[model samples]
Target: MHLHYLGHLPPDDPLDGYLRFDIAPQLGVHRTPSGFRVFQFDFCRDVYLYEELGGAFRVVGKFFPPGRRMAPGLVRPPTETEFQNLTYLHRLGLNNGSFRITRPLGYNPWLHCVLVVDHFDGQPLGEVIHQAIRQDRRNRLFRKLSALAEFLAVLHNRTAGDWTVDFSHPYDYNGRLIESLVEKRGMARSEAEEFYHLRENWRARTCMWEDRRVLVHGDATPSNFKVGPGREVMVFDLERMAWADRVFDLGRLAGELKHFFLQETGDPWAAEPFIGHFLWEYCGYFPDRRDAFRSITRRIPYYLGITLLRIARNAWVDWNYRRRLLEEAKQNLRAIP
Candidate 1:
């Protein structure tokens, strides 16, 4: 097979509408990429829900990036290399130790595997950010994060796997991940420094532990959880759930707090209080990993930079991809403490 350039599409250009011609294996269903508000349910799992598909039927789809396929829509949802990382909560019967994540709700003008998840209503972490912004209160954020850490602690106790059995943190160490990014990603020198520090701070290798483990949601982020009625907090995506370091799960959440939620309102300080609550709420029981929390929190800026680079690098395929990424890099550095 010869390598052919799909060419670059600018960030503003519609990623779903790119031209796919003959001489290539066609990807999944065809559809416009924009419009729906998307968020995550697990590692490499996401859902874009349309409240009303323009008066037709409500539409939603679970996206899998690493495996490269959409749940029930076009064979491939557009944008195979989506910008952000997919976090917790997977569709029913995936890897979460169950066969029923959702019930086939019914049909829509769009696709199949229509899931009618019973009691499938909950506010994702992203939505909570809006609420946090509204009331000028960090309580909800702290509460939610607290629930998440507690949940992880229990999951850690319940899940039992052996690193001697199985392991799955794609990047096991700081140096390994950094070298790959620098080589394959061609990362800038400055960005490399941040990535290096973030990786080291987390003691990245600890995230690779597979043994002496308990069932974990592997990737715990706001987007992966929902606050249901009655203050019921339910987790959705479990694609990356594993019996591993508690820090891995919380680290993911802490890192996200800096990037999407806190930064959006330009209130980095908003993360200040929650950090303590998160660690205090979680580490009380899992005393083994308390230092890990402190490390993760302190390294959030570096992690944010790493995340921005991931976004910037992919966007580089499009015009100004490099320039835009460089700008983000500069901005990211300035945000550092």
Candidate 2:
């Protein structure tokens, strides 16, 4: 609810800060205070503006503030790679028609932000899960899940032979993930050590499993996607996109589903059906269904563990629940088939 100004703007007109970019001139600016959010560690500020082009109201200006300084005392800012990832995924979505994503309008280097093609007009999938209407929308849920899985399969198939695997990536990424939980979220050092041990064992067990890499929507939390009429799913925030095992995305989403249900109903089992439905729908696309299912079953536990550990970094969760999540993640790691 509290606002923190990050960008250096002119005292006369804050909106004028963006109009300086040649990409498009802003005719009107409207700030959406309620829409601003913190995704992971990134502090995001949003604004809706009407562009002068064709006098049409479009362009969602997203500002990524330099929340913290990175290595070598350099400020961590939005990179062009993420912008490219957004564009790539948008084009991929348009080509397949399986899903839709916010289009990248342009990137402003000076402002440390980017303008998206549109401001999403639908409720996020996370919100949809909490709505009572979701019970009546079960069929639509399946439709959305099916479409999402198909798109993921398409992406994996298209990039199967294109990317090379880096075995050290998971270790490095997961290490940093746990460290953030411990340092920033006050996770107990003992739990952090346990997670590290689990990671070590998982690395040995999954030596060859992480070899197959695909273009992954690295941050696949429910908040990153929106659901519309007909269960149409539109994804945004591709900043964490990378070439990794597709299971990473699946596991993160599944863990989110589990976490939400556990928090809402105090029973993780309540989410099993939806998680099963998603995985089953995803496996429908594999040519060798049995083998793919086997692999997914065996390997998803590791990714789900990683996702749970990552989820523990959220400050909003109570300390007790966060400990339970860490314990659950450890159990998932130990139960890996």
Candidate with the greatest lDDT versus the true structure: 2
Candidate 1 per-residue lDDT over residues 36-60, each given as its tens digit: 2223333333354432222223333
* Model 1: per-residue Cα lDDT at residue 114: 23
What TM-score, computed on C-alpha atoms, does each candidate reach? 0.51, 0.79
RMSD of 2: 5.6
Candidate 2 lowest-lDDT run of ten: 32-41
Tens digits of lDDT, candidate 2, 1-337? 1234343334345344444343343323343211222122134434344333333344456655445343442244444556787788766654334367776767765665544455566777766666523465656665676767776676676767555566567778789988999789977788788878877877777543555788888888877887677636677777777788778888888888778777777775777777788888788888887778777877777787778877778777788888778877887888755
Model 2: pairs clashing at backbone N, Cα or C within 3 Å: none
| Candidate lDDT values, in order | 0.46, 0.67
Which candidate number maximizes TM-score? 2
Candidate 1, residue 117: lDDT: 25
